[model samples]
Target chain A: MPDLGLSVLLKGKNMARLLGGLWVALRISLIAVAISLPLGILLGVLMAGKNRVVKAILRVYLEFIRIMPQMVLLFLGFFGTTRAFGWNISAELAAIIVFTLWGTAEMSDLVRGAIISIPRHQYESSQALGLNKRQTYFYIILPQAARRLIPLSINLITRMIKTTSLVLMIGVVEVLKVAQQIIEANRMTSPNAAFGLYLTVFVLYFLACWPISLLARYLEKKWR
Target chain B: MAVKILAETLLSIRHIAKRFGDNTVLDDLSLDVHKGEVIVVVGPSGCGKSTLLRCINALEPIQAGEILLDGEPIKPDGKNITELRQKVGMVFQSYDLFPHLSVLDNIVLAPRKVQKRAKAEAEAEALTLLERVGLKDKAASYPRELSGGQKQRVAIVRALCMHPEMLLFDEVTAALDPEMVREVLDVILKLATQGRTMLIVTHEMQFARAIADRVIFLDGGNILENTPPEIFFTNPQTERARQFLNMFEFAAVKHHAPAED
Candidate 1:
């Protein structure tokens, strides 16, 4: 049996490096979420509007994003854009841009579904109450839509955090990359360093995501 | 009892035509509702009673028509439609209460937001209205916590909060349980007694007779008879009216008669 002790993680500067890597992942995820949420919600509300042209345009964009793989999108944002446009973009920025695009597409669909699922009578009743279109959306529709949206959006955020591991391919030194580096450095000293470090990484991700999952469940129950 | 134009007309719907695709729901329908009068529109299902109320409140746009409120002709697509809507309150068959908000918030939302009334003033008026409907204690409770009857009552109070010149009720009690129906109808009856101008579409024949100053019997998208409740119920002019009343009479007898051994 290989030595599976957490010595590699406890070694000099490894812990801090891993934490720093996690911070990078978390930062990208948070930035993506912050950027995507409002824009996605706007897109969603507009998608629900009666404008045929706008709906058609949004539908094409939404379908393209949904059908294309996230990895492919990341590659396009990172390598393709730089080569095609001759613009020098950083790895972190590329990750942020790709993730924001993906997240916005996903979240807008969620918002659209939630908004559409609201019964027709709710709109009619608000109109009957003498509320203008703007007032109706802000006061009545959005408040109800938020209940359905909050939990789903939180779930998407956690997924984005996990998916940020893919950024290592694009040369972003996130948690997974840090783990690989640590394992490589300790290969001669500790035979089971890879196992120990990977386990630690797993635990870190679980720790980061468990609370979010629990919160989602709690919101679902509360709203129900 | 002949039709009586007892007071000055508050709403006039002329040449209104509503169509959903190939189906014509209302065909050249015209109606005059007097101030301080309670008009109940009754007919068979698909007879356009509800559609007529919706047209008056501008919930459903008419293809060709002029709706005049207090001598002002209402343009359905005009910029002033929102302002016009403020004067016309509507209660739907489904209570349609905002599920996320408390009962008090539901009642005070329009007054505070649309009407720009002071929050305190809206709350005070809402509390009084709730108390009148015996739902004051339920002010802080969400709509999901309320019974069907309670929800409908809150819906009414929400409309009243706007202090509308005219109120439209479209089968407000149609979705309630049998026992819960009375509580909602009683609220409408109380409003009628207070002399609020109202146009109600209902399937409750007995309640219509009790509260309506005039009853409009619609058939196949046309007004078959428009007369006082006493006359319309006792001596309907058209065969369709007589047939409709016979069905109601049959249902009443069946409902009240003793069960067979």
Candidate 2:
């Protein structure tokens, strides 16, 4: 890493710490997406409730997330409500909580749209096949709907990664915030290192997001 | 008249009426199916022919009238509806084969999941059904890879693997290619040879005449005529039936000329 102009950042052991920060960001994102997908499915299905009040509540909740800025959500999670409510939540925990809520809602709506878009006859066929409601969803409808959902879910994971940047506002020391701190510390020694350093952060984001984008396309083709 | 048998009704639909918003379908329709009887419901498109079939299995909720299957009532959210539907397997005009499953899984799914059969036993039964449908070699192939006729045959076997006492065909050949239609008809003819009871909704009069013990003509959501095939084709009772027959004949003739030309 030091052979190129990267040597300045790669001196002694700073590279390892910077990489450790990147790994932490990656770890948070991976856990967030894993937790959010199934949560989203649960919420999306709850939104499909037959009762008017339940449906109305779900609609309000989903629209609330959709309309509000994600940074405001981070603020609400980290600073505004938790302290006021007297809860001792960590910044990392708040960041994860906020992103999970946001990712799950969006993914759930995608699931809802995909499941409902299936020809109504698919459910009728399952009924005719003698499958009970649980069996129908577990076996027929989910398997079919899943084919349409893989790409969308992958896209959601990538969105989760990009949105984690908003967590920097919540004081989560993820990649971008760490990069900003490192550039500030080295501002005197490496005069133009800020742009190059930020470029590394950009590259890290690309490295994380590009493969996911490719995987989404690959899944769409494989399933289609 | 040993085969004349006691007339046992397998299904009794008494004056069922269904509506989709302002569109009234299946208006005051009453019908009965004797055990082991094959009835074909034929009519022009938009006459609610498919909806009537769905009503029998309680796939669509009926606004009025009652349906009794095997002496048990079928009502909305009724406890016994799932078991009744299990006894009634339906094949769609588009084949509706689960594209994801192989021909084998398609057959084995209901038996293993609904009937709670052992996987090994289900596999054995699926193999036999695949052989019966002449799809033994295609068992491992997906529906997308199969021709239309083969897919429909696989669908029939899938329905039969559920061990339904009666099977419903909602124009299974309509989406099939012209060359493939007869291949599917041949499978239907073979099923008839084994005396399997089926209620078919088809536009193919020749298949209807050959297999249906009796044919019921539906038009404007009403039973215009119900009689033996010879009588129904030779002498339709209502003006609507006559008009339907003429149109069907015109369609057949129109379809036949292109092939010849």
Candidate 3:
């Protein structure tokens, strides 16, 4: 039989620390997403542009960012920048920067797909109506594309929330970091504390992400 | 009836040539459309009938030649293109109604956005046009909910809301069912009675004969014949036109002949 004591989480200051860590994680992810989404949409629109040289440059950037792992990127921003450029950066800042870069690239690709998926006739009809390029995009294309982009972008947000766990490697005192600390502190007193704390973290993450996934489903059905 | 040449020419296509990579679609084609003239262009598929219409609307850029609208040369890409496009409206074969917008919104989009008309004014005008087409009840319905003929009627009303000087119809009834084609054709006939200047590209030989002031037969990227419909149908000048008419006659016979014993 395993020790099922809830005392570790209920102890003074422990719950507060865990909640504080969760707040950090949430802040970092939300800030990253807020910074990334508009930039990503712009990049995505540019990706569909006709200029070859601009497209080539954006292609290289997108591929390089996408091909590299998030953990590797986090390390590069945190340790590599400090060593190479002699810059001092906080772990939370580094995590936010890395995630912003990653999120922008992913969101841009989604936007590109959504824009391209619009029927050719839509563009032709708009042009024939004498609508300028700006009017066409704002009135016709973007409205149609938004219906496709919302759900996929919501999925990206959830993924970003889950991926924030890797921020612990950079020494960000996030939810995962706090959970590890609690387990380590109670390792001798309660042999099963690791499992309990980890289960609690898992539940917290599920609670955070469940509503977003449900929103994605609801939007998809509504749009359809 | 004789070919009607009223007033001055409103649109002039002079020595226009268009090519798609290696395929030459329009080979130095030149024609003049008189004011209030209902010009019907007929040819076999891939003969550039639709391309000619697209060129007039500046949808396809010409390789070499100038298009003059009302004595002013039209540029393919320029600040003036939008203003020129306001005078030239096009209704496509697929109807091309915006699926995201309701019928009323679809008809009012250009007037509200491009013409900068107030929303209430545009909606009022749209409602009048909708009533004209007998689609007033479908004003709030989506394109997907309407039948094909209804959608095409809304498309015509959408183009008409611009009050264009010239309307281009590219095989407008080609996508409709046999029963549905007549209703769409009837709408075009009504437009003709109202003296709307139109350039229609269609396969409906009977409809062409009924409304066309002049007919132009295109063959192999060139206008082989331009004459009155009665002449072209009864006495084609070129072998190609005669052959084309014979095929139509044969198809018509096969269509209406008694069942084989």
Candidate 4:
């Protein structure tokens, strides 16, 4: 094994910088997930509700999110809104905002699916027991929906973590951005630096998402 | 006699019509149920027997007509329906016990939450009701853990825990195995002996004959025959009821013929 560009990681403070970058990506995704969970659940319940108007409005919102690409959303959120509205939102802030919005839309759809997936008898039974609408949701609906939501939501977390890599385009200094910088700085010294650096980035992402994916799979099986 | 008549009428359905979209499920149906009376409504599939019970419980809204339980109209909305449902218990054929809850929890959920009873008191009452249903040992078991008859018993206990003025059982044994059907029907028979007012929709003619003080033969969403169980079983008034009872008799004979062989 000649030089496979393994020495690049050994460069002074390079690995530490890459670790910091990974933390940045993790931080953004975690915050986005935290904010999205409750809001998504609320929106999802509304989407699955009886109100035709609310259903139509949320349908349009969901379709809009699903049709548009996330990168375009990032550009629109970070660059378009910043320039048009004249707000001074940081790149990190923009990434968080865009990711949260996307996560919420996706998560809410999952919630709606989970809510409606419950058998109609569940609602009727709860009603027959004289449970009010609120109590029906709190005691009967939510508890059951939650089991379905957990494994799916865990999958969303992994998707969200992977998607956070796109924030590098918006000038957020996450793992991929840091990886690019390291590769660019070592372009002349390490002839195969691009291959190795990109490969390491792949490993980092896999490491980050693997456990979450495993967790999702575990829960899906356990619950089923 | 007038005062007794007025006092005995527990539920009164006055010319009710229920429609699902364009199809009419119950067309201009009227009925009266007395206190401590076990009224069994039997009819062909889609004759609106279950729909009638559902409408009385306010599970389905009536397009036309009024249902009064103890002199108060049971509307499908507002604060009154909750109180109404508390007094009028309905058990489905599917035995819809909450899968997430244990037998005791499923029974006590309404009493503790809606009635605002203490946890200890509600749980104790639930255990007692479970015991009455021969399910005291299974109080801690989840619905999925029990057999069909066991689940149906738990459901009956759940309804009994509410201490309703009456119970509506919509073919409670329809989904059970042949072995399981007897257990559930036995529970209902026990309830009937206690003079618990009930409206039961069932295809089990034997059970209908055994438990019902009055047998209501419904056809085309109309009450064709309303008489004592003896009269209805032996001397049905309508051609439709006579044919319906004959069909059951034929099936019952065929059912036991193989056993005799």
DockQ of each: 0.75, 0.63, 0.65, 0.61
lDDT of 4 by residue, B134-179 (tens): 8899988888899999999999988988889999999999999999
Name model 3 segments beyond 4 Å from true. A1-5, A217-224, B1-5, B251-261
Interface RMSD of 1: 1.4
Query: After superposition, which runs of candidate 1 have C-alpha atoms over 4 Å from their true positions?
Result: A214-224, B1-6, B251-261
Give the DockQ-based CAPRI class for model 3.
medium
Candidate 4 docks at the CAPRI level of medium
DockQ head-to-head 1 vs 2, winner: 1
Determine the iRMS, in angstroms, of model 2. Answer: 1.6
Clashing pairs in 1: none
* Per-residue lDDT of model 3, residues B164-241, tens digit only: 999999999999999999999999999999988899999999999999999999999999999999999999999999
Candidate 1's DockQ is 0.75
Q: Ten-residue segment with the worst summed lDDT in candidate 1 chain B?
A: B252-261
Candidate 2 ranges beyond 4 A from true positions: A1-5, A82-88, A206-224, B1-7, B251-261
How do all models score by TM-score? 0.94, 0.90, 0.94, 0.93
Q: What is the lDDT of residue B93 in candidate 1?
A: 87
| Best candidate (score: DockQ) | 1
lDDT per residue as tens, model 3, A93-166: 99999999999999989998999998888988888888888898999998889888988899899999999999
Worst 10 residues of 4 chain A by lDDT: A215-224
True contacts kept of 1: 0.84
